[model samples]
Target: MTTVDATAIVVTHNSVSQVQDCLSALLSAGLPVRLIDNASTDGTPALVGARFPAVDLLVNDENVGFARAVNQGLAGVRTGSVLLVNPDCVLPPATARGLVEALRDRPEVGVVAPRLIARDGRVAVSAHPFESLTSVLGCQFGAALLPVPVRKLFSGRSRRRAYDACLRPGEPRTVDWVSGACLAVRTDLLLDLGGLDEGYFMYYEDEELCLRAWRRNAAVLYLPTVSATHVGGASSSPGQTWPHLYASRLRFFARHRPSTFGPVRLAVLLRALLGTALALARGLLRPGPAARRRVRAWREIYRIAAAADRTTLSQPVPMTSRSPSCT
Candidate 1:
């Protein structure tokens, strides 16, 4: 029965079980929640209404993407603080209240990111440093080149250090950027900063928002006292989502690091091309759905990379289960 001063903003896209669990957790916390349905084909709206009648629901005519859906929810928030929660993430008790307290206690902090625990019980790299050309390259393709065990170890190390994921749980530290999957920020500051940049349909939006906070003299704090169990990537396939990830990375570089943007873009494109080529070769020999999907994704990414003008490739390539080679 402990109510938090912040309102929870939940964005859903074809979510069923995860949405139920997310809403149940928020309602259990005695927090008011605003749910935004992005034209989900599933009867998620009806499910929310029937299961959690107290929720303030907004159903969009079409999928507006993550950042835009969050913006819509933010518009309806009357509370001083807002917690942006993804449908796939489940919150722990006192999580929202603790985050609100952190926001109130630290006036300099604009965004508070919680520790994200994955389903396998490993802590995900929710908080990360500013994406430089080097960091982006390392995160995207660096691990794939290594042996399976070494790749896992190397990625774990990089993720923990780059995101400060190993920091003590009780203490709060000003960090670069946190994942948008579950973040808390003052309503006023969010509005003043114009919320998330919609240019990014999905990935990198969080980093851009946190970077803006830093530019505006507000600290992006990582709070380990509270945590959320994130079932990451429930909504999109890895193959389908990779392009948006890289494209957003390109956009981020162009906007933030224009001086070296051209070279960075070239390097990103070359790396992507190489990946696609390898995937295509593997799919031809092995012939599996996963491998074929990977090839298709990289091919589309190749188109984006080889584009004469980048603006034309703004629309995100849809996530499809069918393999391009099979068709």
Candidate 2:
């Protein structure tokens, strides 16, 4: 009986309980929603279909990655705006409306995201600046070896708080990109930009979309007035998490930074390669299951870097009992 101008898209993969809770919360917002299931082995599709029949459901034959699944959901949207909410995120009442209103109030903003709060009530880092080769290198594991003060001074991780718009909750501000956990984007602009690049199997696709929007002179804004609870990393296991992350990083850098032709970029690539190699060696010599997982993740990173392609690590690494599972 409620009404909202935007269409909501919720993408689920192996999300059992989280999908139900997310849908329950979204129902209060009163927006038409499309639930896209990427071959989830769990009962996510059945739960949504049985309990929330009003939702438009698209079940895939296999896990088609996050970007592609979201793109498929986007295709069903007839509204002026679309909201991308992860299965693990719960949006508050009127939260979706607030984002849509922001877009309506400001014609220049192509994307807007609400502040993401953890279940523990802590603000999550949702907004971030664009990635550069130097910034990426500074965020690698080797930076942890530096003195605390020195690392804080130079590492990109240190500036994460500064870039997070949630820290300044009173006012809405422009940002480079917001987390895809709960982002509202103009449907027209999203279509023009080809939705998310299917090349990004998982991470950084949101960043790439916002970055492209900026290039087209559209602003990406972060409105902290509204918030969503995001239980992060629900889809990934520890054994394969780092691999997907680093592989996506490699893809983003390759797609955006001309590493092969530019001298500065080439130097940055060399530093990342050497640093990853040293870390992988250290992880191998270390003891325990955690250490072995680190080794596996680092080896995947090294492989992606060597191949200079994200597709090299496209397949999900098999996770065993020893691997940490996200609840």
**Best model number under TM-score:** 1
TM-score of 2: 0.82
Give the clashing pairs for model 2. none
Q: Which stretches of candidate 2 lie over 4 Å from their true place?
A: 142-161, 260-293, 309-327
How many clashes (backbone atoms < 3 Å, residues ≥3 apart in a chain or on different chains) does model 1 have?
0
For model 1, residues 195-281, the per-residue Cα lDDT tens digits are 777777778888988998889899998888788999988977889788888777777777787765677778777877888889988
Runs with alpha carbons beyond 4 Å of true place in candidate 1: 144-170, 308-327
Error of 2 at 21 (Å): 1.6
The deviation in Å at residue 290 for candidate 1 is: 3.4
lDDT of 1 at 201: 72
TM-score against truth, every candidate:
0.86, 0.82
